[model samples]
Target: MPSPEETVKLVQQSMAVYVKPREQAEHVRRVIAYHLQSTVEGSRPGGPLCLIDASANISEPYQGIRGATQEFFKASAANSKALEEFETVRKAHTQLNQPAGPVIKPNRYEILDDKLHLINQQEKSARLGTLERHIDILSEKPATNPDFLSLKPIFKDLRPLVKVPREIVDSLAMDENADRRDLASLVEKLDKVLLKSKLLLTREEQYLQTLKSQISLDPRSVTPSAKARALDTTRNELINWIESELSKASTNADDSDAGHDSDSSHGPSTSGEKPGEEDEVAKKTRQTIMTKLGTVKESYQLYVAARKSLVAALKEPVSMSARPVAEPPVRQPQESPATTEGSSGTASYLLLPYLSKLSELTAAQKAVIAYKSHFNVALAKQLKEACQIIDHLVPESQLLPQFPWPASERAKHLNPGSLDHLTAAVSDQPDLSSQIKPWVFASDSARIATMETVAESIEDGQVGIESINKTLTEIASLFGEVNGDSASISQGDPWADLALDLGLLGPKPRP
Candidate 1:
C-alpha cells in the first residue's frame, strides 16, 4: 500500500496537471459574477460565493485548492496509481527502491494516436455539404476504389546507384553512339536549357493528370484495367492529389459551392476533349517514366558489372599455367582494355568493354520500345543498325563464353572454349544487351513462341527438329558460326565468305 505521504504527492501532481482547466473555470465564474455583482452583497467586504470577489481572493495566497464539484476532485486513486508506476520505473533505474525524485514522463502519444484515428474515421464517414457524400466519387481514394493503381511506394535506398541520371535508360534506345557518356553529360547540364523537352514532359504530365481527374468525376469515364501499368510519377502524384482533396472535403457545407463552381467552370474544356484519348496519353506518360527508370537501372547495372571487373583486374590473378602459353601484352600509349594482360600477368582496365556493350544493348532496347509503341519507317532502319551492332558484340564480348567447337575441326576440343576467366561474377548477371522496358509488347514474345511451335510441327525434319529443340533449350543459342565481317564475307570467295552474311552478296530476302 502507498502511504498517505505518497497520496499527498499524487494530490499535488493532480492539481498541477489540471491547473489550466481550473483557471478557465475561474474566468467563467468571474464573467457570471460580474453579471450578478449588483444582486448580492458579500457577508464580509469580499467573500467567495456565486458572486466572485476578486479583491477577496487577492488578499490571500493561492492554497492549491480545487473545487469539490470538479471531475478531477475524486481522481486521487487514479493519480496514486500513476505515481506508483512512475516510482516503480524510477526504482528500476536506480535499483535501490528509493523514493522517486520528481519523475517526469510526459504521455508518449498513445492516447493522442487513438484520438487521431477517431478523427480520421469521422472524416471518412462525414457527409459533404456538396453533392459528395462520404460515399460520393468526389470523396476520393477509398480503399475499395477499382481505379486505384497498385504501385509499390518508392522509397529511395540508403546507398542508391549513384552518379547517373535516371533517364539514361531512355537514351539507351535512342543514342546512336556506343559511348553513353554523352547522355550523362547532357543530363549534367540540367536547368541550363530554357524550355527543354524535360520541362515540356513535366508540364504535359501535370496537365494530363488534371484532365483525367476532371473526367473521372463523371460516371461514364470507364477506363481499362490499370493492373498492367508499372509504377510511375504521374500515377503517384494523381493518388496524392486525390488524398489531399478527400482530406479537405469534410462536413463543412460552405466548401460545396466552391467545388461545384470550379467543376462547372472547367466542365466545358474537360468535355471538349474525349476521355478515352487520355489512356493513350497515360501510356506515353508511363513510357516516359519508364525510360528514366530504365536508364538509371541499366546504368547502375553497367556500373556494378564494370566496378566488379575492374576490382578483379586490380587484384593479382594467378598465372594461366594450365593453358597454352598466354599471349604477350601489347602496351598502348593510353591504357586500353583491348590489350590481353599486363607485364605482371594480371588483367588491366576492364570497364571499357562493359561500358560499350551496355550502351549498345540500351540502344537495342530503345529501338524495340519505339518499334513496339508505334512502328515507323525511320525506326525500321534504327532497329536494323542496333541489331547489327548486337550481332557483332555477341562474339567479341568476353561476358559470353567462346563457342565449344574451335576454328574448324582441326582445333576442335583443344581450346578452353572461353576466355581464361569465366568467373561466377559474370555468370550471375543477365545478358549485357537485355531489354530495359517499353509499352506493352506481345509481338516478339508471341512470335518467338509461334516460331518454336512451327519448328516442332515439322515432322519430316525429325533429326533437325531434335537438334533445333536442343539448341533452343540451351540458355543462349544461335543458328550457326558467323565468321568474319559482313563486308569481308560478301566480297570474298565462297570459301573466304566465311559463314557471315555479306550485304554485297545478296539482295534482301522476304521475311
Candidate 2:
C-alpha cells in the first residue's frame, strides 16, 4: 500500500493529467481507467494475475494512483476505528468527572497521512474531522461527456474509500421527516413524566396546607386564645342542650292538659276538688313558666362550665399561653448559676437558638432565585409563597423596636437618680404592653409535625428537578460536537489536476 505522502503526490499527478491538452486527456483517462479496472477485477473469479501485472506496466502513473487510493481507504478505516474507541473512553472520563474538568481525551492513534498529519496531538478530533470536507470537495469534481466513461472507473474505485457511514447516510436521508417524529415522541414521554411529578408535588403541597390547619386546631398545646374558643363552644352546646330539654317539657305539658280535659268531660265532679286535674289555661301558663325556668338554668350551667374551663387552663402549664415567671424564688441564693454567668454568654446563648432559623430562611431565599434562573418558574413561585408565609408568621419587624430609646433615657433607667426619674425613663421607651407575642411556626411539637410535611414535599420537588435535569443534560450533550462544513469550491471546472485534486470528478464520496 502507498503511504499518505505518496497518496498526495498521486492525487496531484492525476489532476495534472486531467487538465492537459485534449490528446493528453484521453491518454491519461485510458491509463487511469485501465489501472483501476484491473485492480478491481484482480479478485474476480477466473481473473488472470498475469494481465493485472501487465496492466501495471502499461501505465506507471495510473498504477501509483490506484495503490494510493486503496491505501487511503485502509488508513482511513484504521483511523476511524481508533477515533471510535477513543470516543468511548472520552465519554467514560466525562461521566467520571461530571459537572467539571476536561472532556476530550488525548490522541490515541498516530495518523501518517500527509494531508491529515497537520492534525496536532491537542487537536486530534478537529484534524480528523476534515476528512468529510475533503470528501465533499471530491464529490463536487466535474466530468465532461468525452472523458466521462474513461474516468468512470477511477471515480468508482475511489468512491467507496471515503463513503459516509451507512448509519449517517440513513440519518441524512430521513433527517427532515423522521427526526421530528422521534423528537416529538421523546418530548411527549418526558412531558408526561414531568406532568405526573408536577401533580404529585402539587398534591403534597396542598396536603401540607391541610396539615398546617390541623396543627393550628390541635388541642394539645392550647393557648389562651384557644381556651377562650373552647369556652365559647361549650357555652353554645349547653344552650342547645337546654333548648332540647325545654322542648321535651313543653310536649309533656301538652299531653297532661289534654288528659285533664278528657277527664273533666267524662266525670264532672266526682269529688269537691280533683287530685290531678286543673284549669287548662292555668296549667298551660304554669308549664310555660317551668320551661322558661329550665332555660335559665341551662344558660347558667353553660356560663359556669365556660368560666371553669378558662380558670383551669390558666392554672395549668400544659397551656401554651401560661404566663412565664420573671424571677424564680431565690431561697438561700448566694448568686444563682444563671445570675453568676457572664451577661455576654447569656446573650450569645439566646442568639444561638435563632441562628438556625436565619440560616434556613437565607437558604430558601437562594433557592427561590436559583429555581427562577434555572427555568423552574413554578417551583420558584412556590418557594416564594413559602417565604411569604414564613415572613408573615414571624414578622421581622415585630422582633425589634421601630425606634430605640435615646442614650440619655437608657442611662437613666439603668442607673436611676430617683424613682420618679426611673419611671420617666421607662415611660420614654416603647410600650412593652403594645408588643404582641411573635408568631411561631414549627416552634411547638404539633406545628413542627405540620411543617415537616411541607419539608417532605419540598424534598420531593427537588428530587424531581434533579431527575429531569439529568435527562435534559443528556439531550443537550447529543448536539455538543458536530463536523464543520468544507471550504467552498470554485464555480466552474478548468484544470484537470485541480479538479481531480479537489475531488470534483471521478467517483468521489459525498459528505
Top TM-score model: 2
| Model 1 per-residue lDDT tens digits across residues 1-511 | 4676996686578557544576897896675455445334432326554433222323232356444322222343344545565667566545644555876666869879989999988876663533455456545656565545444333433455566666776766665756766776686344223223444455568879999988745544533222212222233334334434634543232355456556656666778765446545655665675577556545544543454344444353468667454343333322332222231122113334665899999899667645543443344346557667767755665433422222453233223463312421333322222321110123344556679888877764898778886776552324334434422334434544233345244443223
lDDT of 1: 0.47
**Count of clashes in candidate 2:** 10
How high is each candidate's TM-score? 0.12, 0.15
Off by over 4 Å in 1: 1-272, 317-511
lDDT of 1 at 481: 41
Question: For each candidate, how many residue pairs have backbone atoms clashing (under 3 Å)?
Answer: 4, 10
Q: Could you tell me the lDDT of residue 430 within candidate 1? A: 26
lDDT, model 2:
0.54
TM-score (C-alpha) between model 1 and the true structure: 0.12
Q: lDDT tens string, model 2, 191-249?
A: 64564466456656887999998776566777876776555445444444554685687
Cα deviation in Å at residue 1, candidate 2? 99
